[model samples]
Target: MRLDPPPTTPESEHRRRIGAVQEAMKREGFKLLIAYADCWRTANVRYFTDFRPVDGVHTIAQAVIALPAESDPTLFTGDGCLDYAASETAFDVAELEHLPLYLRRHLNADGRVALAGEEQIPVGLHRTIAEAIAPAPLVASNLLAKIKAVKSPWELEQLRHAAVLTDLGMEAVQQAVSTAGQVTERQLARAADVAMINAGADTPAYLSMVQAGPRSAFSLALPTNRVLERGDLVLTDIGARYGNYVADGGRGFVYGPPSGQAREIIDAAADAVEAGLAAARPGISAADLNGAIQAVLIERGYAEFSGEARGRGTGHGTGMDPEEELPWIGPTDHTVIEQGSVFTLKATINHPQVGGLRTERIVHLGATGLELLDTFPMRNFW
Candidate 1:
């Protein structure tokens, strides 16, 4: 069955978003905020004007959205006529060819301006905009990232729909792997990908991680043509995207019944994720939560298996991107977990004898407490 997302963010909510950013700019003394977006980081611009850049092949052309503290936001796209005709955008959109003229017209010579998506902006474009308003000085900031991390009601609903579709995809993969005596990893991945696409997702939320037996040791390994044995352990990491929001998490499975080591590692990872979930309420520091998760594994006598020893951290925020926006739940990050924040907590272990086992769950810090967004059962197999 296909699951659909709730109605997209309304025009009123878009106005509220613009107002919130303007308030933040006022406090920070920024006269204007210029945001950039490409196919990869489209959320930065989508937050202001519900417009996604056309997914062109072989090119990552950018679109710009300029939001002055006191004026209506204007969207500038290279394919101006196409986007203008296709997008039911709330604000005005003009050809990006006129960017230099627009910048010259609106920018104050000495006013402080901030740029969002600074890292994603191409070097040539940045230099052009930088040189256009030289004396004003373009300041690089993560203002939009911080603003977008907190989930609005509409965004939360979108995320929940995405997670439901992701669960459907995960279930399909689990069935594909468990029912087959010798299925290739690529075949299983294709099952999950096609399931999500059929369930109303724009695309697969992330690159599928489908590994069997020894290959599971690589946490982020891509799907391969390796055939799975009847008793092999299978690891599947998949998600789905709906209304620009992403769902992220995965589970492990055994082609048949799980072996002793496989069961033990999977149970230990579950214990760690459960511990993290209990401590995921608002006001906990990301570091403290990371510590809590690790403490469970250490208590279970897996002290030698430091998951973050690979240096990628246990988990991260999931929103516009599949990972890493805010409240980076790692060993050293001190970002305070806040209400309305949504993220994933993953626990993983790579053992010489047990291969790799991982369990992940998504959570939203509701007003009263934590809400589990994903409903998939954490079983060892279908």
Candidate 2:
């Protein structure tokens, strides 16, 4: 629980990541790569330069890392953040306005330009870059995402610490639910947030979810002032962030002694998670892992509440971002699981009459098999 000198990604690792992206660009015939980041979606730029921009009402925080095929990469940010970016990032820092000039200097007439964060980039800036590098054709690229799917040793360590903090938060929620008289959902969520921060978390990975009774039927809901009652099914989904890496998981709990239907729903979700964990390995496809989980839910007569029925995946990759797109654990994703890949293995079942139940675990695929990063028990009835 005590990390005197917190673990961090060294400067050398950032250099190595830049090299990997450059190699990918080479293969894709990209002459220049523009990686963009904002306060919200920061993985692309932060992965390469290690500079997380700060956003404010007066100051719009945005960053771009321009990596040309032939020269060293440059990090560009707002004038307000130039000094901070220079101090934090390993690459050369420049003002945001210079990005067009940098692109003009490095880009050739015939070569194509690849953009890593096309969706998040502002339309005006995108048009400017497109005009600046006219005839070069800006194309969306998933090079960074593909590379980030696999975790390095250092990233795995950070994730492990994140998982520990997340578990502590969940433990605090359980204790609050059991001991507090007439506790509200908001209070439980506050308890979790305080516990994670006190346990050395940078912050909660996302807003803590505390849904009780029929409110739990929704897949995602923010904590409200609804008070707990006896025999009410409570669903809590919480996570913690440490060193910019995050761990996500959820569990089902009861305010008091559980009902027979509540017990059945919780057990089915936990069983599905177990099946998914057993089927997870290096060689399997994401679809196969999801199938294992789905099979359990269907066998338990919860077919209507399966992930496919709900039009959502069972889980997704978790790292620099809480929900990554790669290594997507669902029926449609065909990406192969690789060693050192970390993702959430979750089973969520929502019955119209019985309410909703979910159980999730942060798992890492190693050379041997899947390793569960979370240590908390799956079932909770208080």
Candidate 3:
């Protein structure tokens, strides 16, 4: 069987994006905006130019896209390989040194400029750019986050495709857990990794979190060499990336039979997730959504496991980067739900007696309702 390569964002879409940002700059009184990209945080650059910098563990590769108010955007990078990788993108490619010269050619030093994805831009590089383009105010802004939060139809298609690949990965993980009898956490993680790549994912969205037994309580714990045992709950939170878009989710499975408390928690999480989806429509506040999910969990006698009591919010935004843009679904976030927003809703709980359990789903807020993107079964207490 053959898998299609991840679809590229169309040239027209890129132009549309540039035009929108240019309009935004005109409104904000800025002449140029520089969007930075590094190994992990590539959404700002990729949002504008569809070029993601290749990165490795501890490797410091970087790229930047310069979007002027009324000129063609340009791509600046460290070396030839980055240039080669960006050949098909709509921007003109150049070495990082050329940035100062390009800014000189494109805008006057007195022109107002801004930096997008400032956190992703290294301090030294920013100092150099500021020094080279002296007298131009370089303000930092999250303009891309504002613009990219609303999904273009092209982005939605890419996200939908990514979700399919994620479903494949999750399916493989569940199968390995059910049939492998006894396996190491790494074995289950590898099963998911191989399945997603074979199904056309650029990479696993994050290193698959395969925590067995009590270790499942720790969300940030990596897969260890310990073997999964029967009667233990195995928590698997994994997904795949497609064309830089992510499909992030997870589910819990029991290697053997689950205890009554385990079943109750799983059922409560499922109900809360459904309540979240029900509340996730245009015009609702992020707080409203959070409150709705919290209500469900509280109603189910898990009030201590609801909201901040459980250690994390109900969910966060998802897109080109897994944590792309945000209006966190928590008690305090007042960001309104808007049409075309893509995000995830998660129901999670951890107790000293019952261990940890979670279920996640990706969704896009359409004109009518939430378009559930993740099709993998929510195998509660599997």
Candidate number that wins on TM-score, 1 or 2: 2
Residue 205, model 2: Cα distance from true site in angstroms:
1.0
lDDT winner: 2
For all predictions, the C-alpha RMSD in Å is 2.3, 1.7, 2.4
**Candidate 3 wrongly placed segments (more than 4 Å):** 1-3, 56-60, 298-311
Query: Looking at candidate 1, what is the lDDT of residue 84?
Result: 48
How would you encode candidate 2's per-residue C-alpha lDDT over 20-47 as one tens digit per residue? 8889999999999998888776788888
**Per-prediction TM-score:** 0.92, 0.95, 0.92
- Which ten contiguous residues of candidate 2 have the minimum total lDDT? 1-10
Give a tens-digit lDDT track for model 1, residues 1-382: 8775446678888988899999999889998898988876677787876677766632225788889999898888765444542375888888776777888899889788899988888898888888877789899977777787788888888888888888888888877865776689899889988988888888887787888888877667898999987656677789888877888987877676777887777888888888888888768888888888877777776766646533356677787678746868888888788788889988877675567756888889887889999987665743
Each prediction's whole-model lDDT (CA): 0.79, 0.84, 0.79
What is the lDDT, from 0 to 100, of the residue 253 in candidate 2? 82
Evaluated against the true structure, the overall lDDT of model 3 is 0.79
